[model samples]
Target: MSDGATTRVVIIGGGFAGINAAKVLARDRRIAVTLIDRSNHHLFQPLLYQVAMAGLSPADIAVPIRGLLSRFRKVSVVQDTVTGIDLEAKQVSATGQSWSYDYLVVATGARHAYFGHDEWESNAPGLKTLSQATEIRRRVLQAFESAENEEDPEVRKELLTFAIVGGGPTGVELAGAIAELSRSTLTKDFRRIDPRRTRVVLIEAGPQILAAFSAASAVRATRDLEELGAQVWTESLVTDVSEDSITIGNDGEKLRTRTVLWAAGVHASELGSALSGELDRQGRVPVGADLSVAGHPEVFALGDLARTEDDSGAVLPGVAPVAMQAGRYVGRLIRAELAGKERRPFRYVDKGQMATIGRSKAVVETGRLRLGGFLAWAAWLLIHIYYLSSFRNRALVLVQWAWSYVTFGRGARLIVDREWRNPET
Candidate 1:
C-alpha cells in the first residue's frame, strides 16, 4: 500500500460510525484520518428524548468531537457541512473547502421525515439534533406556561394537551416522559390549572408501536403508557398538522393542541444521493457485504447512510450498535487491506435492544431472553450510562437520574427560548 507512504483517509460525519472508525484507524500511524461533521459535538442521540423531556441537559448527552479525537495524533477533526462528493475525483466539497482522500467513509446519519408534509415541521418539531431537542423542550414547557394564564377552559385544555405522532421508541419515550413531567414533576409547581390533568396522546399509524420488538413487549409498553394516563391510538394516520390542531384518519378527526412532536419516520441523509450508486426508497445507499458501494471499492458508507444486511440476508436496522460495529469493522478492514492481509466481510453480532417507558418501566430483548419493568429499566440505565461519550457525562447523568428517582424532580427544566404570544392569538 503506497510503499509505506502515509495514506489519507477522510471520514464524513462525526457520528457513532465515523467516530468509531476513526478510533480504529488511529492505531495505525500510516493512516492519517480527517473527520468532518456539521456539529462540534458528537450527540448521544438515544438520550435525545431526555433532553426534549427536560430530564437531561444537552451537554449531558453530548461530547465535543474534537476532544474525543484529540488524543489520537493521527486523526484531525473538522467542523463543517459537507455539500457534495465526487467519487471519480476522490474529493469532498464542503462549505468553503475541499478534501481529497485515498479512502472515504460516509456515515452522515438520518433525519426525521414528515411523510411529504414538510410544512407541518414548523408547528410540530422532531427530535434529532441538540437544537431540535431543545426546541421540543421549549415548546413542551411553554405549553404549560401558556395554559396557566389562559382564562378560557377550552383554550386551557387545548394548551394542556400534547400529541405525539409515531409510536416508535422516540414517540413512546416522549409520551411517557411528558406524562411524568405533567403528572408528577409539575403537579405541585403549577397553580391555576392542574398539571396532573394534562393529556398526552400517542398516535400510531401502524397496528402496534415498537413493531421491531416482540408483540408481548409492545403490549406491555402500551399498557405501561396507558397506566401513565397517556392515550395510545393505533391504526390512525395523521392527515394534516396545523398551528393548533391535527387531523387524523380518513374522517379528519381534529385534535386541538399547541404542542405536537413527530417521531414517525426517517429517511437516510441527503448525502446518499450525492453518491453514484442507486439509492433505496429511504435514500440509503446500497452497500455490499464489505460496506463498499457498488463499482467503488474505495468509497464506503456506514450507519443510516447505507443499507446493510446480515449474513442471514436480513437487513440490519440502523441502530447505534450496528453503526459502531460497522465502523470498527471498516477501520480494521482498511488496515488489513493496507497491510496486504485478507479482508473479511462485516458480520454484526446481535446484541438485542431495549427501550425505557418511564422511571421504573422498560422492556428488553436479547436473543431468547426477555425482561420488563424494574430489571429491564436497570439494564437500560446502566447500558446507556456506559455508552455515554465521556466519563464525566456518565457520572453527571447517573447523579441526575438518581436525584430524580429519589425526589421526582427534574433539574434541567429551565425553558431557554420563550414564546410569549399565544398560538391562537
Candidate 2:
C-alpha cells in the first residue's frame, strides 16, 4: 500500500512453502511481498526433534525471516497472526490491522489433532513450532533430572518411561533419539535407576508402523525399533490420557509415563477451515490439478493445508518437497499473470521420501531406487542440510551432527523452564 506502482502480494505463512515463495518472488522488482507468520524465524521442521532432544539449537534450525531478505527491498516480513481475509476487497486482517493485497497465498501449515476429545491436548503434546520444541526439550531433560532424585521406584519408573503416540517419521525419530539418550548417553549418570532401563513405547492404531512406507520397509523399521529396546505396539490405540498414565484402547495395556508425545495425526490450521470453500474431512481445501482452490484464482493454498490430487487421483502427501514445489509453481504462475498470460496448472515433482530410524539406519525411496541403513542415513543427512535456508545453519548443523556422531552426545540440553504439576488434571 505504501508504493502505488507496486502490486502487493500477501503471504500468510513463513514455513517451507511461504519462505520459498517469498525468496522466489523477491527476484521481481515490481511485486511488493509481505510475509506474515506468528514467529520471526522460519523453522526447519524435519529436525525439530533433534532440537527437542538437545542435539541442535533453535538458531541452528531456525533463521530470522528478515535476515533472509535483507537485501531484497521489495520484500517485507511481519510477525503476526492472520485472523481473517476479505475476499471481495482483496485484503487481509492480522494483528488488529488490515492490509490490501492483489494476490494472497495461504501456507499456514497444520497442527496436531485430538479428534473429538479436545481436553486430551493438555496431557499429550505434539512437537511443531519452536516454542513447542523448546517446551519438549525442557520436559525431556527435566524428566531425567527428576528421575535422578526420586526415591520411590514406581514414581521414578513413571518419570523415566516415555510414550510416543504415533509411529510416523517424527515419532520414530524422537523415540530413537530419546532411547539413545537413555541407553548410551546417560548409561553411567544415575546410580539409583539405570538410565538404560528407561522404557520408550510407540503406539499406533494401524496394523504396522511407518504405514507410509512399503510393507518391507515398515517391517524392517519395526524390527529396528524393537532392537533398540523400544516397544512398538502395532494395532494399539490410545483411548485416554492422564497426567500420569496413558490408557491403551480396549486392550488392558497401560504405559505409566509422565511424558507423552503426540505425533498421531494433524489437521489443517484454523485459516483453512475459515475459508468458505469446500474442504475435506481433515479440513484441507481440495484443490484442482493446477493446485488452485475451486472458483478462486486470486487465492492459492499450499503446504500441508492443501489437498491436491495428482493425475492418478491420488492426493499428494504433505511433505516439504510438495510444499516447496507448490510454492515455486505458484510464484511462476503469479509471474505469468503479471505478464498478461494464462496460468499453468501445478504439477508436484516428487523428490522421494526418506526417514531415519537410529544411528546409521534409514529408509529412502527416490525414483526407482530403494535404499536402507547406513547409505540411506547419509543420503538423508545430506538432503536435509542442503535444503536448509542459511549457509550458517548448514555449517552449524553439519558440525553438530559430526560431533554427535563422534561423541554420542547432544549439545542443547539446557532446561530454561521449570516443570508444572497437574499436567492433565
Candidate 3:
C-alpha cells in the first residue's frame, strides 16, 4: 500500500475523532496515516462512570489502538505523549520523537476543569481517565471498609458520606450508582455499617441537573435520584475542597465527607494551545466550517478541542456524535482534495441525547420522540452496547449487565490500589 508519492497525515489523540478520522483516511492508498496517543487504547468514555462505580471493568470499555488499526495497512499507531507542535515545520513533537506531516489532525480532547482551583483536583478526584475511575472506586469501597472498623460514629458517618460535584450526566450517574451500590450491592456484604445509610450528595451550581436536557427530564431525573436516596443540591457552589470535606456557598456550609468525585466542568486539552490560534473561554480552538483551523486549512481540530457553530449560530456541543461526524467530514474532505473533487462544508446532524440515572431509569430526546423511565434505560443500554468497538466487549458487557441485574451485584467491585492499603490511616 506504500505509494512513493503519498500524503503524510498525522493524527494526534486516538479518541473518537482521531480514530474515526484514521479509519476513514485509511481507505486512501496514497495517504499514509500515523495516529499518536498517550494511551495505548481507545476508551468508551460514556461508560467510564460505570467503571468508577465498579459496575464495569476498564477492559470492558476500552480497545487497544494497535489492534484497532492492524487492518489498516497504511495507518501506523504510535504510543507517545505529544508535547508540542511546530506549525512552521508542519511536524508534531512527542516525548521522544517528532514526525513531519503534510496535514495534521488534532483530536486531543478535554480534561476536568476545577475553575481556577487546581489544588482541589487532589482533594476531589474527577472521573476522566481509567486510573481516576479506579482511584475513585478504591476510595468508595475503602470508605465502607474503613467505616466497618471505625469506632467513632461521627467519623463513620463522615466516611459513609459521598459528595459529588457537578450535576451533569456523569455526576447524576455516579450519584445514582453510588446510591444503588449502597442499598443493593453492599447491603448484605457489610456487617458493621449499613451501606443503605450511606449518604450521597450531588452538588450543582446550576439550577438543574443535566442542564443540557429538557427541564421536564431534569425534574424527572431529580425525583428518581431522590427516590434512590441521593441528596440533590442545586444552586450550591463549592467554595473549597479539603481533604476531609468540601465547603459550599458563600455561607461556607461545610459537608464533611472523605470521598469527593468531580464531574463539574472540562476545558479543552492543552494541545489546543500548541498552535497560535484564537481559543474560546473553554480553551477550544475555533475551526472553520470544514473543521479546519483558521489561516491553516491543512491543520484540522476535531472533538472537544474544536469550537464550531451550526447554521443557526448555536455552537455545537462537545459530544461523541459531533466529533465522529466531524472526523468523517475531514477525512472525506482530504480524500476529495486528493481525488480533485469538490469539497463541501461540514454539517452536524443533531441526533438525540440520552442519559441514565439508575436501573430502569433514564431520559431520551430525539426530535419529537421523548422517552423516559424503562424505555429510555433500555435504549441507553442497547445504544451503548452497539457502540462498543468489538463484539467480544459487547458480549462481555451484556453478560455482566445481565448478571448484575439478576443478582443486584456488581461484578467488578474489587478495590485494587495502593491507596486502599491504609486509606483511612
Candidate 4:
C-alpha cells in the first residue's frame, strides 16, 4: 500500500455512516480522510424525539463532528453543502469548492417525504434534524402557553389538541411523549387550561401502526398509547393539513389542532440523483454486493441514500444499525483493497429492533424474543445509551432520564424563540 496521502477519501455527510467510515479509514496512514457535512455537529437522530418533547436538550444528543475526529491525524472535516458529484473527474463539488478523491463515500442521508403534498410541510413539521426538533418543540410548548391565555373555549380546545401524522416509531414515540407531557409535565404549570385534558392523536394510513413489527407488538404499542390517553387512528390518510386543522381520510373529517407533527415518510438526499445510476422510487441509489455504484467502482454509497436488497430480494430498512454496519463494512473493505486483499460482499448483522413509548413502555423484537413493557423499555434505554457517541452524552441522558422519571420535570423545557408567533392563534 502507498503511504503519505497517496490515497484520498471523501465522505459526505457526518451522520452515523460517514462518521464510522471516516473512523475506520483513518487507521490507514496511507489514506487521507476528509469528512464533509453542512452541520458542524453529528446528531444522534434516534433520540431526536426527546428533544422535541422537551425531555432532552439538543446538546445532549449532538456532538461536534470535528472534535470527535480531532484525534485522527489523517482525518480533516469541511463544512459545506454538496451540490453534485463529478464521477469522471473523481471529484465532489460543494457550494464554493470542489475536492478530488480516490474513494468517495456518499452518506448524505434522507429527508422527510410529504408524499405529493409538499405544501403540508410548513404546517406539519417532521422530526429529523436538530433544527426541526427544536421547531416542533417550540410549537408544542407555545401551544400550551397560548391555551393558558386564550379566553374563547373553542380556541382553547384547538390549542390543546396535538395531531401527529404517521404511526411509525417516530410518530408513536412523539404521540406517547406528548400525551405524557400534557398529562404529567405541564399539568401543574397551566392555570386557566387543564393540560391533562389535552388531546393527542396518532394517524396512520396503513392497516396497523408499526407495520414493520409483529402484530402483537403493534397491538401492545397501541394499547400502551391508549392507556396514555393517545388516540391511534389506523388506515387514516391525512388528506389536508393547515395551520389550524388537518383533514383525515376521504370523508374529510377535520381535526382542529394547533400542533401537527409529520413522521410519515422519507426520501433520499438529492445527491442520490446527482450520481450516474438508476435510483429507487425513494431516490436511493441501488448499490452492488460490495456497496459500490454499478459504473463507479471507487464511489460507494451507504446509509439511507443506498438501496440494497437481501438474498430474499427485500430492501433493507433504512435504520441506524444498517447505516453503521455498512459504514464499518465499507471502511474495512477499502482497507482490504489497499492491502491487496480480496474484497467480500457486504452483509448486515441483525441486531434487533426496539421502540420506546413513554415511560416503562416499549416493544422489542429479536430473533425468538418478543419483549414488551418494562423489560423492553430498559433494553431500549441501555441500547441507546451504549450506542451514543461518547460517555458524557450517555451519562447526561441517563441522569436526565432518571430525574424526569422521579420528578416528571423536563429540564429542556425552555422555549428560547419568543418571536415565533403561533399562526393558528
lDDT of each: 0.90, 0.83, 0.90, 0.90
Clashing pairs in 1: none
lDDT of 1 by residue, 41-60 (tens): 88899999999999899989
RMSD after CA superposition, every candidate? 3.1, 2.4, 2.8, 2.7
Cα error, candidate 1, residue 263 (Å): 0.3
Residue 100, candidate 2: Cα error in Å is 0.8
**Clash count list over all predictions:** 0, 0, 0, 0
Candidate 3: tens digits of C-alpha lDDT, residues 294-324: 8888999999998988887788998999998
Candidate 3 deviant stretches above 4 angstroms: 1-4, 419-425
Worst 10 residues of 2 by lDDT: 416-425
TM-score of each: 0.97, 0.96, 0.97, 0.97
Residue by residue across 88-153, what tens digits does model 4's lDDT show? 888899988998899999999998889988888889988888888888998999999999999999
Q: Model 2 segments beyond 4 Å from truth?
A: 2-4, 419-425
